[model samples]
Target: MAECPVIEADELEKRLGNSIIVDCRYSLSDPEYGLRAYLSGHIPGAHFLDLEKDLSGPKGRHGGRHPLPPPEQFREVIERIGGTESSEYVAYDDDLTGASRFWFLCRYFGIRNVRVLNGGWEKWVREGRPVSTEVPSARRGHFQPHPAAGMVVDINWVRRMGRGYVLVDSRQRERYLGVHEAIDPKAGHIPGAVNIPYTAVTSGRGTLRPKEELEGVYRGLGGRPVVYCGSGVTACVNVLAMKLVGLDPLLYSGSWSDWVSYEDSPVATGEE
Candidate 1:
């Protein structure tokens, strides 16, 4: 395929019936809800991949909630889900964070033909395009994945947060503030991380807000940046969003999950 920049919902709508579209509107925090939403209706020919179950491997005390699956296992998932050498994949969600995780996984596995659906499934439904209540059964794809090293970072790298490094958080204001304490044990955010929240960067059409707007947000941060969320996944979306704005960001793979797990790590509460 050509260069895979983010594509508009209209552009994706055109390819839906004819292409391999995956509805990745999953919540590791709420898998059942996401699946129920998908079962109710989804883009025709679209398949579903849950972030916790399908995209990520089993969680461990050290691996965080949505740790990356091993390459061989991920390759199995790719083939099982109909991802092939010839298959061009488009992943989307009502929430870009979930969709972006799949996109980031595709990149990490060196699957080059994948792209994020601009505006995602929510935009598709609003436009009155075709949708299906039944999930389609797909033949196994012949695709194999090669893992990329530079795409991920570990805890040691994350500890080096400043200097030339920038850290971004993708949680909402409420959750970031430690006001909401439902998910992780600790509710506060990592000290020194800026709150970007992911959603504020998009337009109504499901595409990114203009590059100028994004540049202003990144430049406002004033340095090379690293992004994170409750886990490492949504943070990747923030990085991808920044990529749309022409800003290349590093990934804090452990993210807040790892941050909070340690007793001595700094935590900040409340909105700023």
Candidate 2:
């Protein structure tokens, strides 16, 4: 079995100096929130990754709000952060949702040694762990993109979905139901998609819930799960959950935003 990418606070603290800890904190509402918060203070020695600038790519018409960055540009980011094939990395934010995005992107780009901080920044601060206003510079390192195959699928793939595909919407129930739309223009999910709000994967304290609990939420879903959210961001939370529990799932990289972009695409509302 592959090792889970989620790490607890205590383990992360001990590995601080030995790891490339990335602060992936962001707020969808206020785009500037992440950098502002980072400037105030963050985990000692942690580098900041803006959800929009660093993690996501230049958005075009069809790709969602947060498209994957161009491969060469992303390679530059990795090298700039002193990441190499051998570097151990940790990403943390207010909760797993934010950090999980970094975890997913790194692994997809072939940086397999990264982990998301379980319980994330909230847990770290609540436990009285150290914080720092000073930033540490890292020595440059070499890296190359080895994009993983079949990890992502585009909108056309979703349109021609088979009965065997288990499409999952990672937004909240209301958003999934089309009862309360906010970010995306559409108010429903991909036809036949099921609701599994990413929050279900985390505990009240913001850490992942027990393994068995996760299994119950995802096991025997009966097909390959292709998860998406309003855009392609929070869906990573569900992707991280499924992978953590030994399940293989694909990400609909453009997600609902791309889905709704096509004038003729189908949308399903209410239960299921």
Which candidate number has the best lDDT? 2
Candidate 1 C-alpha lDDT tens digits along 157-244: 7776558776788877888888896778888887777898777787763566777877776777877777888878778667777877
Candidate 2 lDDT (Cα, whole model)? 0.87
Off by over 4 Å in 2: none
- Local accuracy of candidate 2 as per-residue lDDT tens digits, 8-73: 889888887889989988898899999899989899999988888888999988898889888887
TM-score of 1: 0.90
* Weakest lDDT window of 10 consecutive positions for candidate 1: 1-10
Task: Give the C-alpha miss distance for residue 179 in model 2, angstroms.
Answer: 0.6
Q: Which lDDT values do the candidates have, in the order given?
A: 0.77, 0.87
